[model samples]
Target: MFGLIGHSTSFEEARAKARSLGFDEFADGDLDMWCSAPPQLVEHVEVTSRTGKVIKGAYIDSVFVPEMLRRFKTAKRKVLKAMELVQRSGIDITALGGFTSIIFEDLNLLREERISAVQLDWQRFTTGNTHTAWVICQQVERNAPKLGIDLARAKVAVVGASGDIGSAVCRWLQRTGVGELLLVARRPQPLVALQESLGEGRILPLEEALPEADVVVWVASLPQSLTIDTDSLKRPCLMIDGGYPKNLDTKAAAAGIHVLKGGIVEFWQDIGWQMMELAEMAVPERQMFACFAEAMLLDFEDIHTNFSWGRNNINLAAMDLIGEASLRHGFKSLGLEPASSSSPALSIA
Candidate 1:
């Protein structure tokens, strides 16, 4: 019995992937994978994505303050409550996704029960091919010849440049020939480092600098409740929300600011269920997720889990590698949404 725990709403896609990995999809339309039980062939465990169902567990880490510790304790209590329900219903292998894995990422919760823990890398696999910034830079350059969007004429502003992802984006902007680059972040250290690495430029914090930018890229993991006054964002501007959980409030963002969202090209073949097994077995070892490839490969010969690469700082190289790998593997981008008739959307968000 494999219990995949995640928000069913947001991770319907991941659930599908889990099914591809041998989980079965029952008549209820929930994921049911073949479970490795003691001396038994297999069993069925339902994956519930419903809310208010208690999820019992902990993500305790060695390093944290008292306040953080209290928060973890509360979260663990909630998780344990949910897991208790699943146990009563009969689930042997419990896997956590999204935020659940964040808590378990640090602590070993499986030791407390008969449940097995799992954390699917999802999108953030780090491959060595290209960095996300480099990949975005390449897209800018690649599209420069074809893009009605001119990079040379654009006044660039990279928000949160004091951080890793922001710094990479800034470097690419600098080299890609922005007419002017406005650096926005917290303190002045990274801004100074960027300037030193790429020569003199104007740098300011995000609040003071956003109004003048023609192109603004947000890449930091800001806390919740942080809000951007849409009016401060420039008109006729292109805003790229590159941060996970999204930095700019999509709802509150200025209308017509030309938003550029980011995501990898996912190929979901409705080749139906017929060819799934073959595809799984035949997927090349090198075709693993970019983020966990090296680590995951350490344990197995067929390291195809990370068919797409990932990184915290958004490695453009990993992005490129995933793209290149998918193409080489003859994986066509699935037609999704309005794209249900066209190709999958692949490129920087």
Candidate 2:
């Protein structure tokens, strides 16, 4: 009964990651309502770890702020219903998917007839997911030659450079030797700070940055008031949008920029028996959401779930740890799809 709170690709992918890490079986029709319950919930509640127990007994799902709060409310009710059904069917463990884990902060308030309230905090889950996205993207770049993408000389623009995801990407690009990295954001100070921290490169506002970028990652965590129009972006760059309402406006994407929905790919180790049907199915990195990577990474060490990364703060070391864990878990990036270097890179000309 994991509630996929938002409609964006990242949220759904995160939801899938939750399924991979927490849920055991994935039947043909997930909505069928006839699949057998997980063995842990039915007969082996305490055979393993406390953290897994905490997550298993919880029904995780995604939920954003004011924009989709209503959706969260609705999803909350549906989950409550699912818990009730599960209780009647002799199952006690609740379903907590990755997105649901985001909203876990408010579990104390969630009250059902026979079950404990759900817990979540979107801010934490989102930041964790975004951090994982940054780590995952970099790892993908490390193996980009296999994917026919290059990062050594990539002209990249990070839309939310001032924030956690954007800044992390900037640092990652620099570390990986991206030839020209352009960071864009509303406030230049944070971007400049990141630039200063990196001890090199350019950090400019969005309007001045995108024209010549080879790969542009728009992972801005924006408010409802913000929407990126075509006039604000340049042409033909690979646009990776990780925003909720979507940072790449539909028309702006028409400017010939190939837009990709950033996502995560999680590997399930302990649940191999449950996934025997798809034994060889290693979830492509694109299949999981960034937050799920964050959770899975944290889950591995049995650490408490928290907002470990975001725009408010920059923790490069923590980001590195998450990146290392993903590589160990068999996840890789989609690589940088290069545009012709001969074309003018920036609009300043």
Best by lDDT: 2
Query: What lDDT score is found at residue 220 in candidate 2?
Result: 64
Model 1 stretches with alpha carbons more than 4 Å out = 1-148, 222-224, 247-252, 268-323, 326-349
* RMSD after Cα superposition, model 2: 10.4
- The models' CA-based lDDT, in order, is 0.41, 0.46
Model 1 residue 137 lDDT score? 49
Q: Residue by residue across 1-349, what tens digits does model 2's lDDT show?
A: 1111222233344235436655434322232221122212211211122223323222222222232344555445444444343444432222233333334323422333344443333222223654455654654364333334466866777777766556667766777787788877877677778778878768766666766666677776545454456554444456666654444545344655556445434333233222212112223212345554455445544454443532346465666776676565544443233212221231111
**Model 1 lDDT per residue over 182-269, tens place:** 8877778767877787685688776777777767767665566667676776555565555544335443455545554421122233
Q: Which ten residues in a row have the lowest lDDT in candidate 1?
A: 32-41
For each candidate, give its TM-score against the true structure: 0.48, 0.53
